[model samples]
Target: MPGIGPLLGAEFLAATSGDMSLFGSADRLATYAGPAPTPHDSGRVSGNLHRPTRYHRGLQRVFYMSAMSSIHFCPESRRFYQRKRSEGKRHTQAVLALARRRVNVLWALLRDGRRFEPAQPATGTA
Candidate 1:
């Protein structure tokens, strides 16, 4: 929600048909949005993953753009992106991971009927 603007929000609603019940879960929504990679394993080639082909590109674009924008405006998003980079993921991969995470967040918000709230930093008392 932090990165979602009016246009992105509209696009997301359009892509998802404004029915969270259709998705049932965040994983299903991510799969539809193309951020959840699928296994491409062969006989001896396990552990390989690839982007799904039969997904909604518009939805994917909405998530990707929102995730990219969030990196600049959201501290939580920036830290997640930075951590992914530190783990040796490329920019696109890191962004995709962030997008997947955001899908979960969005799904939970919709399911719970609540607005987004940034986490408060923990304080240490002497």
Candidate 2:
């Protein structure tokens, strides 16, 4: 919820109605949001990733925007984006990857009935 404003939060709720169980898994949720690239294998071209024609574009927009917003305000998320950029990923590609990753984290948080908490940096080895 770090980047999810009232509009994004309401959109997410309207899209899922807080029913995390209905999707069965985070991967499924990502696909529903149109980010989980589907395999487009043909001949020698194998494991090619492409978006499905039938997907909720609005929901996808919500996640994409949330990820973009987080990049500015969340340190961990900004670090993750920077890592992706350093690894040669383009802006859209990096943001979509982050959004997909967020799907898994949000799923687990909801499943565990927990709120989002910023990770504390390690002070030293115990």
Please, what is the whole-model Cα lDDT of each candidate in the order they appear? 0.92, 0.89
19: Cα error in model 1, Å: 0.5
Q: What is the lDDT for 1 in model 2? A: 62
Give one digit per residue, the lDDT tens place, for model 1 in 90-125. Answer: 999899999999999999999999999999998897
Model 1 whole-model lDDT (C-alpha atoms): 0.92
Which RMSD does model 2 reach against the true structure? 2.4
True-structure lDDT of candidate 2: 0.89
Tens-digit lDDT string for candidate 2 (41-77) = 9999998988678888888998899999999999999
What candidate 1 gets wrong by more than 4 Å, as runs, is 35-50
Candidate number with greatest lDDT: 1
